[model samples]
Target chain A: MTITLNNRIETFSPQEMSITQIMDEKSFHFKMLIVKLNGTLIPRESWPLTVVRDGDRLDIIHLVSGG
Target chain B: MTIIQNITSHLSVKKAGIAGAGGLGSNVAAALVRSGVGHLVIADYDIVTKPNLNRQFFFADQEGQSKVDALRENLLHINPKADVEAHFCKITALNAGSLFGSCDVVIEAFDCADEKKWFAEWMIAHYPAKPLIMGSGIAGYGSPETLRVQRSGNLYICGDQRETNEKLVPLLAPRVIMVAMMQADLALELLLQEKPL
Candidate 1:
């Protein structure tokens, strides 16, 4: 499945992806983050339960730390 | 010519939180207060020491005074209308949520090299909806042009995002305050966007 991630095209194997799985796959490990799915804010607790499908929009805004 | 527009949202920022009351924290508090954030909650365990005068917002007379207290006084001096809360203890991952839970936005202003990421993690994990603005590379004072703010979702990072911490190169006032001001500016933007007037 291909979806929009950070304004870019991304493809996952199962045609669907959980927020946590995508974060792991993309190595978005910055501790400070803001995750949104299809324009709705996704609480941290919902990352695991929130799944994305084909063509869905997911934005993972995280503070890139060089500390 | 129009110098600016719609900047009247200062009061709309409502409450902001600063986790550390040092250079970045204190200056951020000052900027937010002057800019009109309704309430500010600041936390820090350290006191105003001589070396801190190089960049922090404390005074010589404030030496031996706790940073949280001194900063509160200084902010109030700038804007008597400023609503400030001072915490006289260290902010750890454990107490971060309670200290800043009511804040509309949280500024990660710790001066330590090691605690930045951990504290950011704790705040975001506990309050996912609250915007967290962090200062990453604010140490030293030469590259002024490198300072910038990057935003994603509810997280904003301001600074060169490359320089080492204070231990390696002293925290000069100019660069630190510049980054602190940038963080405060971004906070204003986030708050306005959060509670559109």
Candidate 2:
């Protein structure tokens, strides 16, 4: 399955995965993250339960410090 | 037509809420006030110190003063008629909405990744209709050309997008204020675009 992650399309073998699994697989280990799946925000508490299907568009933003 | 008259006529009735009164917050608040934003709600629990003088808006004389108080004083000095509300407390998911609910736009000027994430998420979740201006990665001696503004829905993020480790590079005034001014300009632009209810 192919999906756009941060505007870059990538293929995944599993075809489906939880948001948490996707983050872990992609090494998005940053403590500060804003995850949006197809324009809907996935709360931190819901990452594990939320599943990302094929063709989904994910926007993963990292906000850092210094002002 | 005088600049002050034009600014007052355009912005005398708008209100802005700044989440942190540090380098970005103080400078953003000052620019908004000078532009004649009618009211401001500024929050911060930290105190000014000698090191803050390098980039923050507080003067050396303001050392040891609470950031919210010092920032309010400085803003008032700029526009005495400006209604400045200072809150000396840490903003969390619970109180962020209530504290800034009445504001037309919210500015995120936090000093930590966790705080920025929390505030952005909370605002996006609870206040979906409001505009949120945030900053990230304004540290060291980065070139001005690297800075850029990106927007997604109601969220506008302005910064170099390069994470500068504070330990490795000190936060300087030029980059910090440049991003702050970007946030301020975006806030004003959003405010101007809104049609009165």
Candidate 3:
């Protein structure tokens, strides 16, 4: 399984895992999220820790202050 | 609207330590005293100058007075029963801990962001139970409505979204005083076990 981490997700695993499972056991501190899969932006809470398939392009977006 | 009948009830119980006895600090100390805050520990290494009088509530007669002493005098005048402890030294990392040790809440009314960050982190790390209220971004003469509140755990932050614009609106006395009152009010609510203001 190939996985990628972007933004502040370097500590998160990209392997096959559910987002719910990852958040339930690992980090509950994060209050913002928008995961991307293969150039498609996933919903704010849909990113799972499941195994990442090939050709997946991940982009993690968080809130920023000021323009 | 819980109107505290005995204003001195909780005011006499907890002490509030105020850092940066300049414009924001002066306003904070005065408001705390007026609100009957029990004990207030104030620290400021600056002196009153002509320009500081434009916004700061100190008297024109106190031009050369130490900011800490002037603040103490003014606070006592407003509330004589309150204990106003003034430290003429600056609130550096060396002295921040001791100064804020007994304070139930620490107000970082510092103009400089770096200094405020240092005090906030130090207070949170050393006094995890005591809350740290910080000021930020209240720069221009824009909407006081723009002043928002941000809190993560025990650290609370207020002020503008960006730095002040010296030409357009450079945080005047009215706005700074308004925001300072908000900070003081929030601190009192937290200390007195009342709902957030």
Best by TM-score: 2
Better of 1 and 3 by lDDT: 1
Chain B structural similarity (TM-score) per candidate: 0.89, 0.95, 0.91
| Runs of candidate 1 exceeding 4 Å displacement | A1-67, B1-13, B163-168, B194-197
TM-score per candidate, in order?
0.72, 0.85, 0.71
* Superposition error at B69 for model 3 (Å): 0.2
Error of 1 at B139 (Å): 2.0
Docking class of 2: medium
Better of 2 and 3 by lDDT: 2
Residues A1-67 of candidate 2: C-alpha lDDT, one tens digit per residue = 7888877888889979988988999988876778888878888899999988899988877787888
* Candidates, ranked, TM-score: 2, 1, 3
Local error of candidate 3 at B157, Å?
Answer: 0.6
**Chain A only: TM-score of every candidate?**
0.89, 0.94, 0.47
Q: What value of lDDT does candidate 2 attain over all alpha carbons?
A: 0.88
Residue B20 displacement (Å), model 1: 0.2
**Residue B164 displacement (Å), model 2:** 2.8
- Which prediction has the highest lDDT against the true structure? 2
Candidate 2 per-residue C-alpha lDDT over B36-71 given as tens digits, one digit per residue, 9 for 90 to 100: 899899999999999999999999999999999999
Weakest 10 consecutive residues of candidate 3 chain B by summed lDDT: B160-169
